[model samples]
Structures are given as structure tokens and as C-alpha cells.
Target: AHVITHYHRTIDKVTERFLGKRQIGTTGRGIGPTYADKINRVGIRIQDIFDENILRQKVEAALDQKNHLLVKVFNRRAIDADEVVESLLSFADRLRPMVADTGLEIHRALERGETVLFEAGQATMLDVDHGTYPFVTSSSATAGGAATGSGIGPGKLERIIGIVKAYTTRVGAGPFPTELFDESGEFLRANGFEFGTTTGRPRRCGWYDAPIARYTARVNGVTDFVLTKLDVLTGLSTIPVCVAYEVDGVRVDEVPVNQSDFHHAKPVYEEFPGWTEDITGARTFEDLPKNARDYVLAVEAMSGARISAIGVGPGRDAIVVRHDLLGAS
Candidate 1:
């Protein structure tokens, strides 16, 4: 019944200043720096905010190196320690009530035969340890991260559900094998409204890369997939799916082991017949067009995970559920 909020974002500064022109295109929300502080053992916690002296001391210590980098390296204004401390203190009364030992609570709940769900931010391709490397986020984004990020044990997590868009889209820089430069990419972007939910940045659209989906499924031990935005594929004459990648004259069925190989990977496409009918009103999987049903089955076979649910439209009830996600019979 409780949620765990890891790391602190009392300061808004990030390591983007260090990246210079070769920036990884972060959202500039200080997430990188906050996680950096956690690893560096200098991060302030939610509990620290309640103690005025401890809060001020930690903020001052963190800003000591940060302000130096901003002023000398980035040529940015130095952040005042008092201002940062004061800003954090202002949220103490409001956040204190919500703060709890979420990990312990979740563990206890599961011990009592209650269900505990662990949701994650970002995608597997954006994981810091296992993803596209320098182009990834600051933390672990895969299922393995769920154990470390939250204080829950990995054995307790029996199911890993991956939510995938029917078509591919990426917000920032990375190696994308299926990126389309023509009208087809634009059509998906426009119809799906492919934009970053928080930053509003336009996402790069592409065809579904089954190889990438399979790679994620393998890495995360995904049991089921919730396929989304299937309705946006409507009205197209044909749909090209990236079944594999051609890297350096060789067909790579799996994700390349090295970043260089991934960057140069070329998509090997498998074209499927498209549907022209509007399927937003479809309530069941059987209600979908035969071509659409075939496409879903083909993707499921390639993805290495069962398609438990399919999102046909934007509404809450638009999902076509095939199985219970909670493992209930």
C-alpha cells in the first residue's frame, strides 16, 4: 500500500556540464546528479530534511564540489548553500507524512499473502548497466534494478511485465536499427502522438524492432508484455518489422555485444499486411482484423514473451486482456 521514493533531488544541478558538446541529452532534471550523490555517499535522504543542521551540512558539502564545477568548468553561476538548504527544508512538513520504510512494508505485505507490484521508470534499453551505455539513464532500468532500487528481494518478484508500444520510439540519442526517415515514421509519430510525457520533446519514431523486444525480454526475464498503441498502426498499407539486425556484413539475431557494432547495425525487415479499419472500439482480441491478429501473434512469437494484453486505443477500457497479470487463475 506504500511507495518507495529513492534518492533525493534537493539540488537541481547535473553532470550535463561535464558532457560539454557530447551531451547524452538528459532531461536536465538533476536525476543523474541525485543518483550520483547516492553512490558517492554524500546524498541527503528524506530523513535528513527533518534535521535542520544535518540538511544544511550535507547540502553545503555537496555544493562545495558542485559549485566549483559550475563556476570554473561550466562557467555557470555558483549555487548558494543556504538557498539549497532552505528550499529543501520548505518541503519537510509536507513530505514527512508520506515518508515511510516502503521496503519493509512491502516485504511484510507479501509475507501476509498480499500482492506487491514493483513499477519502474524508463525502459531496459535506457538502463545504465545493461543498456546502450553512454546514451542510457543514470540508474539501473531493467528488472534487476527493481531489487536494488527498492529494498525488496529479487526472489519475491515472480513476474516481470514489459509494456511496449506497437511501434518504436526514442526520445534521445542512441543506436536505433529501425528508424524511418520517410513518411511512415511521420505517420506513426503524428498518430501515436509520440512525445516525451514530461519534457514534451518529440520522439524519434520507427518500425517495431522484434530483435530489441526479444533482447529486453531475455535480459529482464519478462513473463508477459502489455502491447500498446496498436490502433495507431491503422490505415497503413503495410507494416515493416525489424526481425533482425545486419552488423558488419553478418546477420546479428541478438543485440550486438559492443556499442560500436550496435551503432552500425542495419535492420532486416519482415513486412506484414496492414489494416485500414478503425479498431479503437474493439473490446476483444478476436474483434481485431485478421491481419492485425496475425501481426500480434508474429510479434509475440519473436518477442519471447506472451502478449497478455493489447492496447487498441487511448481509453482505460481499450485493453484486450488475454490473461490475468497477477497470476490468479
Candidate 2:
């Protein structure tokens, strides 16, 4: 039994009421609010559900402030404390069986020399501390966040793998240096099926950015990269990859230190020859076309990490594994 921390409905309503018009393209699932409560030292944990009185007390305390904001600021109806308590209480019996000290469990497993795989939710550019401010997610999405969120030390984790798209795509409001406004963007969107899994929002597509990949690799200590959707770039005569950025008058080779500089940054692209051959069925690295292989190698050379795997198509078996990710060999 592993107790995974999850979002609460009360937190969701609070977030909704707080960010009335200035929504940062959230899934409206209260993930941000729940994390905020955890940080604010007022969150109700899964274990709290078992204790009805304490759960009710916490819910009432939270709503006392939330109701004020909803009623006065947002003009929305205040959520009832009794309703929230009842909702949480109903899930206690079912959730108690699953709740355990997951952090301790993980520590014990590692003590027995067992391997633990930690799969993170979001990308590096969406990280709160490192990413673009005011436009980033509330939680830490970087490698450091893995330790904090999972109650593990950073030294315990090894082999950080970054999943990068052959081209770039971002949703919601943010500064994209190489955002495409023409048919190239549309082509990538349609071909790559660039749609948000939860929000159903169409992603803003752009050319591949080597600088961003390099910067993420540096920040997250990425050992390998898994490049996806290379097949979508096929059939085009030429593909442009952003090698650097021109911020104001200077050519910046790395991510700008300031958000304002990044917002005004312009991409400096280097053209690569595109391939026409279908790569969806290619299983081996050598099976790819000369140009495709060249493109992969070129991108690898520019990016900080080695590309161990490449996704040619959208299918589960469409990946071409170049190297052993676990280093068992």
C-alpha cells in the first residue's frame, strides 16, 4: 500500500475562485491549490480522512478564509464546510486500505537493494523555480523536485532521462522564442497531434530548440534524451533547429537569466536536410535514412545529453532504441 498525495476538492474550489479571470491554463482539478496548501502547512492529508473530527476541523478552518475570498472577492458562492467534510469522510474507508508511508516504503525497498523508478509528471520548462516566472506550474517539475516530492535524496537517483520532442510545442501563456505562426506550425500541430491530454488545448508548435534542450540537460543532470515525433518532420525539404537566441542585440547561446530577456528573445536557427522515407517501421538505428540519422546525430551533438532512444511514430512499438538506458551491458 502506497499513499500518493492527491488534490482535494476544497483546494480546487479555492484555486478556481482565486484565479477567476487570470487562470494559468490549469486543468481546474485543484492540483495547484493542493500543492499550495501543502506548502502553506494547512493541507489535509489522506490519513486525515480517517479521523472525522480532525478532518472537519481542518475543512472548517480552510473554508473560513476561502469563503471570505469567494464571497467578497470573486462574488462566487462560498463552499459549505459540512459538505466538504462529508465528501472527504465518504472516501476514507476506501482510501485507508491504500494509504501507507510511501516515503518510508521506498526507503526500505532501497535498503534491500531494490531499484525504484520515479516518473515525474511535467517537463523542465514547466518547473516553477527554474522556468519562466508567473507562467510556470506551481510545483517543482525539475530533477530536484523528484527528491522533495518523493521524500528521497537527490544522490539516490541516477540516470535522469529527458523526453524531448523533435520539434517544440507548449500550451497556455508563455514566452516561446521560436513559435511558428505559419503553415509549418499548422503542419507540425496536425502531424504530431499536438493537443493537451487533460485540457484539450491545441499546443503552440515551433522548430526544435537545441539551447533549451541543452539548458534542461544541464539543470536536470540529464544523462540521456528520448527524442519523439521525428516522423512528423519527414517529407519537408528543410527543418530548422534553434541553435541560439538573439536577445535584443546580443546572440545568447544559452537560456537567458532573466524572464524579460527570454520574452523578447528571437531564435537563431540552423537548417538541416529533411528525409522523405517513412521511419515508423524502422526498429534499428541504422535502419533510418542517411539524412534522418544525420539529423539525430547533429541534434545529439548540439544537445548536452546522448540520445539513447528515438520515437519515429506514435505507436507503442515505434521507438528505436540506440543504447541501453540502464547501462546493464
Candidate 3:
């Protein structure tokens, strides 16, 4: 578990600023530092807030080192332990009612034959250990993480459904092999509304990268894929899908083992005929246009997972299910 403080954000800003051009494009929300504190055993847990002395001691101990780094190394002001303690303690009353042994509760639900759905906050490409190194999020963002984060046994888990867009869009900085720098990029960005949910920054748009999808399927053991934003690519003459990558002029069928190779990889595209239909009202797979159905089938064949559902529009009910998500294998 990770806990965040005011100093954590400050630390994030300072450290990132120090790194200059080489900074990892984090949200600057103190997530990385909070995780670092947890690993370093200097983190403030939620339970510590109920005890003022324990909270104060932990805060002081953490600040003892952090303050030195701030002042001596970063040339910044030291954070006050008292201020941090007071700020944390302020949320105790509201948090007390919500705090529980969630793992135990989940187990109880499982024993009662109730369904439990674990939703990850980030994508597989942003997973700490399995994703692109240093460019990934602070923790695991895969099916295995669902068990670890929820304190559930790995053997008890089933049905890892991957949600992917019709095309690719990456926020912040990283190597995107299929990234578009032309009008096609702008067109996808405009139609897909490719913007960050939190930052409101315009996303880097690209053609669908099937190699990355295949990589995700292998790593996460994806049982099904929910293809979203299919309607966005409606009027294109032809849609390009990256079936493979060319690293140093050598064609590779999957993601590279080395980060340098991945960074330099170029997309090998396979063009799919586009559709001109308005698919939002379509409730069944049969209602889709021939070209749209072909595109889905082609992507599914390459993606290494059955596409269980296809999102036709942004509405809650704007989906066509080919297979049952909870009932099917």
C-alpha cells in the first residue's frame, strides 16, 4: 500500500526538474514517491493516522532524510512534520467509516458465490515490471496485479478481459512505433477525442499496433478483448494496422527484448478496407457493415484473443456482444 503527502508532490516536481530533458512523464501526483516510500519502509500507512504519536514519529523519521535531500541536494525548503501530521489527521474521521479488511470482505463474497470484478487503474503497457522500463507506471497494471492488490489468491482468478481502442493513442512521452505525425494522426485524434482524462492533454494518435496487442495478450493471459471506439474509424478510405515491426531493417513479429530496439522499431502495416456506415445504432454483430466486421475479425485473429464485445459508440448500451463476458471461457 502507498500513502501520499504534500512533500511527495514537491519531491516529484523537484526530482523531475533536476532530471531536465530525461524526466519520465509522470502525472506529478506523488504516486512514484509514495511507492518509493512504501518500498523504503518509510511510508505512512492509513492505520498510523488514528494514533497521533505513531503518525508524528513516522512523519518525523521520513522527513529527517527527505528534508535533507530537499534542502542540501535540491536546494528546496524542508517540509514540516507537524504540518504533514495535521493534514493527514484531518482525514481520519471521514476515512474511519470506509476503512475495512477489503481482502477478507472479498473472500467472504467469493465463498458466498458472489461475483467480484477487479478494475485496473492503468493499462498493461504502463505496468511497472512488465511494461516499457522507466516509462511505465509505479505498480503492476496486469491481471496478476488484480490478485496482489486485492489480496486474492492467483489461482482463484479467471477471465482477464483487455479493453483496447480501435486505433492506438498514447498520452505523455514514449516510443510509439505506429505514431502518426500527419493529417491521419490529427483526424484520429479529432474523431476519437484523444485527450487525457486527467491532464486534458492531446494524445499521440496512431494506427492500431497488433504486435503490442499480441504482446499484451501473452503477458496478461487475456481471455477476451473489448474493442472500443470502432465508430471513430468510420469514414477512412483504409485503416492501417501494424502487423509487425522492423528494427534495424530486420522484421520482428513481436515486441523487442531490448528497449533500444523497441524505440527504433518501425511499423509494418497491413491495410484494411474501411466502412462508411453509422454503427452507433447497431445492437448485434450482424447489424455491422461488411467492412467493419472484417476489420474486427482481422484484428481479433492477430490480437491472440477473441473480441467478446465491440463498442460502437460512447453510450452505455452502445455495444455489440459476440460472446458472454461472465459466462463464456
Candidate 4:
């Protein structure tokens, strides 16, 4: 499996709430601008760092331009090109030992009939081009990004597994139609321990919106859905799932393109009975409490994807693997 992470947004922009006017509390890893620069062709690639002179050239050009903007326009301190170059060089040296042509590598592995895995970081709804715009992330976070980022071609892709919380959540600035700031929202957050793994910021929590999941499943060609955090709903007497949205007088099954439409879209919830007690330690599907199993089946019906695996807790062992997602045991 190749685990790759995209660059984060700039420190200054994240705090300013650039798009949402909400304090996103982004990790400020410069992921946004880095991807922006990449798309703009001004960004540095890992391969480019191999040539020392080329590295220096790119760093100097970027720093010279950025420092000017920082001092003149933003009134921030200037960054030294030498320091940036040095840091990049250090990182490159570490990468130099580990880097390989993934194209050749994966091809060789497949030729040998070995199993390979491509794990992704972000969700489809957070994708820059396909997701909710302006509030979206920097890179192609969807399954399509796996091919480009991994240096692979289209036909080799056998399956794409999409992971989703049993309910829903979003981290940064965007129009979240199902977001709840109320006590029920608190219930989901508190019970699910809804927090960002990378940013550690509190995730915007809501119910499972089947329409949203179906949209993502379609766009990404998701073969299956790994419903995570299902155990969090075990103790509730009543659990709500968002099946559709009703805006104005119109009932909508798909997500609205406009932010205003989305913001105004009220979730039409389908309530289910919640089970009391914990099912986290249960390893087998047969061992799962009846209510828990019913919940999974119900979610599968609503989400429009087969629930392949269920995540009960944060530990690696906490996952209950039902069907083989990658077509390998």
C-alpha cells in the first residue's frame, strides 16, 4: 500500500477563514497553495528536487515573489530562500533513499501477481473540482486522484473502496447541508468522538446522508462502502438518517450545486431505533447485537452501496471485515 498525503493550506489563510468565514483551524501545512501552485505549474514536484541547481532556482523564484507579497501586501515577515532551499533539500535527501518509479514498481508487482493497495487520505465531497467549491481542498481528493498521484493508468484499476463515517462529517469550510449545531449534533460528536485525525479539529458532524453517499459512490465508482464509526450509535434509543433534502417547497434527492441552496436545504430524516450497550468488541457479524446488525443493513439500504467493513473504534483491530474489498484475503 502506498500512503501519500497532500500538502495542507497556508497558515495565514486558514486562520483568516478564507472561504467559509468560519475558523477552519486548518493544520496550516500550506496544502492549499501548494496544490494550487502545482495546478498552476509553478509548484515544485518531488522529482524536481533531485537537481540541486533546479531546486535552488525554483525556491529562489518562489521565495523572492512570496516574500515581496508578504512584506508589501500582507505585512508579514519575509521568508529566506536559502532556508527554504535547505529544508527542501533535507526532505529530498530522505525521499531520495525511498523514492522509486511507482509506474515501473506497480507494473512489476502486478506482473508477478502480487497484491497492491492504494490508500487515499481525503473524501470525494472534499475534492477541489468535484466537491463543494471555494470551501473545497487543494488536490483531487477523490478516487480519480489515486491514478494521477500514483502514476498509474485507468484500466488497471479493479476497484475503489470508499470509506465513510456511519454518519457524516466535514472538517474545513464548505456548505454542509446536514450539519447540526444543536444538541443532537453534540450527541453524535460526543458519542462518535468525531475529531480529525490529521488536524485534530472537531469535525462537523451530522447523520448519514444517503444522497450524498450515493453521489460520492457514483462519482468515484466506489465498489463498496466501509461504514466507520457505527458503534457510536449503539446506545441511542432513536437514530436518525438523512435520506433526502427538502428546499423551499421542493423535495430534493441530490445535493444542490449552489451554496445558498445547500445551506437552505433541510434534511428529511428517516428515524430508526437505536440500541443500548456496546458492540465494539464483537468480531463476527453473527456475534453482533441484533440492533447493530439491523443498523448496518439499514445503512446499506439507504447508502446505495454494500457495507463491506464496519469500524467500531479507533484501534486497528476494532474493524470488522465482512467482505474482501480488494479481492484479496
Candidate 5:
């Protein structure tokens, strides 16, 4: 939600209108608008959901501010607080039993040695503070955010599994170092189906960037990498990976702090042979195409983290494993 409506407020109104359409590839989820409210501290949670009196006051306060912004800046229609409150109150029957201490529940489960899989939204490159500034998502989407977002202590976080694309991609606006603007970009986008899962916007595609991956691994304390979308690279004559960047005639090993330097940085490419045919059903390391294996090895060397599992396609069993850091039962 925070990833989608970080800037605009009309997302809810617009998205809600397209509830049944398959045009946007979305189901009119209210996630983005709700997250926006959470950041503004005007969100009515499940707890506030119970008490209508408190919920009424809360909705009125939020609507007051929202309507002001809508009328003054966007030149939009004003929202009625009473109407909004009444609509929200209508959901009280379904939301009652679902409201509980989720953090406490997690703690109890952990005490019993039950494994908890904490799934995160978006990728590290989309994270607000760590990723490309101003163009990034409003919240932390990296592995580190799992602790706070899930209401678990940092100590409970035993490992951070970083999911990376075989090639790099980004949505909206940002400084993408290896973004391919030519036929290669289009090919990757088409083959990989490189589009935002949330917004359905076409992703900016590029070769695998080792420097950015290294930075992400270090910053997120990633124990392992689960490289996805590898099968998209099949049947290519050659493949290129960005091993380093040349900024102002000087080569850098890591991502630079200066935005200007990053903007001006030229990718120093390392080329490899592209594999023909598919290896999506491969279950073991040796089952991969020879060139595909080389690509993973090249990435592992530069990423500064072990390659645990490689996702060839978007299937539950599509990933081939070298090792599983989260462990296999």
C-alpha cells in the first residue's frame, strides 16, 4: 500500500472504481491508501474498529485533514466525515474476532519452536531510506524491516534471505545503474514478465548489477540470496553483468553515497555466454544450463553473500538449491 500511493492520494478513489476490471491486473485492494493513513497516524486499526464512538472521532479528524488537502491542492470533491464514519462502522461485524495481539501470538509460537515465515513486500531497491531516494517506496521493504513490521525483536531475526532478480528491475522513478533502454531491455521485460505485482507498471529492466546486490546484502545483513527470474535469460547469444561502475573516471567497488556520482556512473560490464533452451524444472545445481551456472557463480562472487536458492521461474518448486539457509525440513 505504501509502495503504491506514496505520493498521490487519489489512488483509492481511482482504484476502487476499477474493482472488476482486468486492465490494471489488480483487484482494487485498499492497501496503499490504508498504509498512507498509517504513516499519517490517522489510520483506524482493528482495535479502533470495535469502538464506534472512538472510530467516529478518529475518522472525523482524518477526513478533516484529507478533505482540506483534496480541495486545496487537487481541486477534488470534499469528503463527508459522517458518511465515511457510517461506512466504516458497517464493517464492525466481520472485524471483531480478528483483532488481537499479533506480536504476542508470534512470541507464543516462537516459544514452542514453531518456524515462522515472515514474508516481506517489495524489494530492497524499493526501500525508502536505503534505496534510490524520493523515487522509492514509502516504507522499508528490505529484510531488516521484517523485525519491526512483524512486531518481533531484532534478536528473534536469525537470518535475512534476500530475494534478487537474475536481472535487475525497478518501477516508478529512480537511478537504475544497469537499465537497458534498447531491445535487450524489451526482451528481458517481455521474457521475464517484468511488471509490478502491485501496480502492474512495466519494470525498468537491466543486466544483473553486482555492486547494488553487494550493497543490499551488506545493508540488510542478508545471509543468503534467492535469485529469481533466471529462466528469462534463456536462448540468448550473450549475457552482460555489471561488475562495477565508473564514476568521474574512477572505479568504485560499492554504491556511492553521492547521488550525482551515481547518476553519472557508467556500468562496467562483464560478459558471459547465454544459455539456450530451458532449465526451469531443474532441481539440482548440475541440472542448470552451463552458462546459467556460470551466471549464478559470477553473481555469488560479487554479491558477498552465499547463493542459497535460485528461482528459475515463478513457481513454488521452480527454485534450484545450492543450500537452504532458512533450512529444509
Candidate 6:
């Protein structure tokens, strides 16, 4: 694993500040810079901590260039290499005991008929290679990444379960075609509690984006989707779903090929009648209100894959499972 040095955070902050309005709206927790260090072949790794001399040398080498950029280019204070090494070394003893050949362990478990789940931290739209360029995360956030990151063959993977919001929400700066700027947006924000878990920043809310959902299904080979927060739209008179995009007078059913076109694309919505009933207690597909079922079916038709599960509310038991994710669909 690539280690996050103190300088990485400092670098990320300084660079984002330098960008000003052009900032990528990252968490500023040293993620991008740490990946940069990994690619630059000067990164401090988990193994480096066990060897203090190697850790110090790597940190000093990275800071040698980074400190120059900080002092001369950004007019910022130089980060001390000693402090960085010290901070990282402090966690070595605890982390070592837990580290193992995870790939081998997973492989053995599979051989013994034990199931292993690979969960991604970020969404498909945040993948570095597949998502919106220059506005995406530092790493892969797709099903394929699970295999590569875990040191498993792609063939070892069985099914891909995609978790999608009934309505879309994005944390950082990016092109959102169906983004709501009115009271409906506020309603979703308030009802869904659309706030970043760590930053507590308000997420940009939108309706169900079918085109993006289809794109994700194609890219990630999603077998099933868990449609969450259907209860949020319960009180609305109508719900608008983005079925396609109007890009320069042309209707595009998929995400636009060009970034500029995507940035300017306008959503073409298909409306669904809303329901008034509270669905938090409903545990089965049949228990849902007629209108809510229609909305789900409409979205399911537009979305590329089957919505195997529906989240009616925030509670753990609020989900309605139409299909078994671990079993054949």
C-alpha cells in the first residue's frame, strides 16, 4: 500500500489553492498526491515503515523536490522530512501485525467455498480512467479495479452489484445534466440527507439519471442495482427522471463521447407520478404503493440492469429485495 506522508496533504492543499476556481474539490487528505508519488516511483510504502532507514531516504527524496516547489513556486513553508518519517513510523508496529498476503488468503477462501465481497469506495463516475477526466478521483472505481487492486484475476469475479441512489448526488465539481436548482433539489437534500460523510458539505442533487445508470451498467458489467432512497420522493407530486441528454440539439441516449459536450448537455426528462404513502415499513416488492412501484419499474426499464433491491427508507430493514444478489438472477 502507498503511504500518505504529511507533505502529500500539504502539496494537495497548496496545489488546490493554486488552482483557485479550477480546483477538483478533492478531500485534501493527500489522496491525489500520494498516487502521484506512487507513479513517480518515490512513494513511501507500507513495507518502508518496517525499515526506518529506507523510510527516511524515500521521504527525504520526495521532499527534496516538493520542498522546492513549496518554497519557490507556491511561496509556502517547506515540509520537514524528519517529521513525516516520524509520523509514519509511529504506526508501523500496529499495522505490521495486520498486514498479510490478502490475495492469497482470498484465493484460498474461494477454494474452500467461502464467499468474498469486494466493495469500492468511490462510484463509477469517479474512476480515473473511465469517469469524467480532470474532475475524477485518483484511482479506479470500477468492478475491474477490484481484481487488479486485490491481486486477483478478473475471471475470479462472479457478480457485480451496483448501489445507485433513487436520485443522483455528487460531492465534488463535475458536469451534472439533471441537477436541480429549485425547491425539489432542496427537498431531496433535506429528505435524503445528501451531505458528505466526512466533509459535511451539501451534495449536488439531481433526479434519477437513466443514461448514466446505463453507462455504468455497460462499463462495470453490473448484474444488479440496489436503488436507494426511494422514500425521499414520496411527497412530491411528480418525479422527473433523466432518460437522455439533449446535446447541441441531438438527443444522446448515453453519456456524451466528448467532455465539452457532456459539460453542456441538458437532460431530457421523463416524468413519473409520485406517491403519498410512507414506505419505511414495507419489506416486500408487493407491499410498496402502486405509484412507487410504477416509478421503480419505469426506472428499471430505463436503467440497463435489473433493480434487484429497493431502499424505501434509512433503516436497515427498510430494503425490499426483489432478487437475491448472491444467487443467480
> Where is model 1 more than 4 Å wrong at Cα?
1-21
* Cα-based lDDT at residue 281, candidate 6: 88
lDDT of 5 by residue, 1-329 (tens): 11222223464555445444423222245555667788878777766656889977887787777777677765678877677667667777886776678899999999999988898777786677887765555578887788878789988888788888889988766688899999999999999998888768898999999999999998898888888888999988999989999999999878988877888888999999999878888989899978899989988999989989988877899989888676742
Candidate 2 lDDT over 157-177, as tens digits, reads 878989999999998777899
Off by over 4 Å in 5: 1-40
Candidate 5 Cα RMSD (Å): 4.9
**How close is every model to the real structure, measured as TM-score?**
0.94, 0.93, 0.98, 0.89, 0.87, 0.99
- Residue pair clashes in candidate 6: none
Candidate 1 has a TM-score of 0.94
> Candidate 2 — which pairs collide?
none
Assess the local accuracy of residue 194 in candidate 5 as a C-alpha lDDT between 0 and 100: 83
Global lDDT scores for all candidate models? 0.85, 0.85, 0.93, 0.76, 0.79, 0.92
lDDT of 1 by residue, 1-329 (tens): 21112212322334554656777878777677677787888877888889999888887897788777767866767878787777778888999899888888888998999987778889999999888988888888899988987798898888999999998999888888899889988999899999998789989999999989998999999999999999999998899999999988999998898999999999999999999998999888899999999999999999989999999999999989888898852
User: What lDDT score is found at residue 38 in candidate 3?
Assistant: 91
- Candidate 5 residue pairs in clash (backbone atoms < 3 Å): 1-32
Cα deviation in Å at residue 170, candidate 5?
Answer: 1.1
The candidate 6 region of ten consecutive residues with least summed lDDT is 320-329
lDDT value, residue 321 of candidate 3: 97
Clashes of 3: 0
Runs of candidate 2 exceeding 4 Å displacement = 1-23
Model 4, which residues run further than 4 Å from truth?
1-25
